[model samples]
Target: MEELDEDNMNEIKDKHEIGTPEDHLSEIMEEAEKYHPGYGASVMTGDVLIHALEIKTTSFCTLRCKDCTHLIPYTKAPAHMPAEDLMDDIKKIIRVAKVAGLIFMGGEVMIYPQLAELMEAYSKEGFYDRVGFVRVTTNGTVVPSDEFCAAFRKIKNGYVVISDYGILSSNRDEAAKKLESFGIKVNVIPEDLQWRSLGDWHHRDYSKEEAEELYRKCHGKLYLHLYRDHLYHCYRAPVMNEDGLIPHSDGDYLDIGSMSVEDLSRRLPEFLTGLSCTKSCFYCDGFHEQSPFVERAAQL
Candidate 1:
């Protein structure tokens, strides 16, 4: 892996190099086509690169950290995507625009044993190759067991991104070892202590500010934000709270099933705007929050 330098960090914050959301989507789908050519022309145009599928499996979690967003307590368990529905969507994405990959996320996807089955289904459909990678974001509260290892082994490329909240035992070292033992790459995301500052009104909470700065540094680079049923360009671009979901002007929220790669590619511009809803926004770790990774660079 290449080292991320000041210049690199600046570029990422600027978001300039990321290209328009549409272009980004096209690029990823095209890349996916390298492995699966059966994908449709829309796969070459679909905005899967800029748009990532975020599968929210569960609303409840065992850990309740101080800076936890997703407002787990406030969220309710909707419904899990049935095996058939998920498979159908995966097949469509592969046939249509070749998605870069699927991000299996949740309050805790591991808690649901069916997640392994989900991975196996992708493997069976010959769609795994079309998927650039399969990443799962999890808190290192549970270690990978034999069954979990076997499920992931079916997929050629898989990674586990562990968010270390400083509460897990052994500082998550044991869990990392367990996953690596299964021939899986385990990456640990250092806990962002700055999250603690959010609890204090005057402690210079820089979550959103830093995110903007980081966005600018990345040259206006934007990542896809999939929430509820609609997809927004950036994580903070959409408003989904207890009241209702509001989209930015010129932006429309479409059901995932109704959405085509071309439809998303065409709407890239409207998706990237910084909406008014951001005015009262509270930052979550999902966005750019100061982490130990940043702190280490400062010391150097």
Candidate 2:
């Protein structure tokens, strides 16, 4: 290889620096037009499209990792949501908007008792057609069941995102192999993954302009939370809300159970844009680019 200069080395080192806040804003705003800016095309055509949203299936995980932004390790009584309710919510969401990437999230998706039922429902509803793609994450501790393997194969554009934390995620390789054998995509999370620690739950008391800038700049904004029937604009907010760490916000979340198609059409676009920073913003480290790093998957 040729000699690398200082500027070239710096560029490689800061690869994760996605860009400045203006870059993020420009990209989000530009993409908004395609994803029903007024919630128009999806509602009128039935050929739906909505910004990506993640479903929080459970907080129970195999390992109690330190400095988890979701604070998964700190949840005293991590529990699963009623599968029936989640399915209902999924159906309602699919009816209103096209999901970009319908993710099956959890404490440990493999351990969820009613996963088969949810997978069955996913197949039955033709979600494969409605979604851009389907993704399920795992930590490689649980072996893949034949039923789930079959269900995964049924997904037209589905993939497994796995992590290998040595013994903790021992079954990771097996899961990947089995998933691949079934003609499904298996994505191994890179070992050098970077996790930004957002600190403890207490409020930071950020001013309006500070909070707005913080909210607009972070990728946490993209990590929208779908808990119970509400769609929160930020992933950390709902988790922190459930943990009673952050004050509740009526304005920050969408009552998915209450909204009509027209209501959903208008609101989802706004929800995705996340223009107004919520109370969670004040308490959050903003998952900012400059936030301190936590070693990925560091067990408690």
Query: Quick one: best TM-score, which candidate?
Result: 2
* C-alpha RMSD of each candidate structure in angstroms: 8.7, 6.1
- How close is every model to the real structure, measured as TM-score? 0.58, 0.83
Residue range 1-300, candidate 2, lDDT tens digits? 022354644554475565655565455434433332432233345344554567777878888877766677766668887878778777877876776656788878888877777787777777644565577888898987888888767766667889767667888888888889988788887676656577777878788999888887776776667876788877778767766766777777888868766788777766665476887888887776666655667777
Off by over 4 Å in 2: 1-15, 20-49, 258-262
Q: Per-residue CA lDDT of candidate 1, range 230-255, in tens?
A: 45444333333321332233233434
* Full-model lDDT for every candidate: 0.50, 0.71
lDDT of 1 at 126: 71
Q: Provide the global lDDT of candidate 1 against the true structure.
A: 0.50
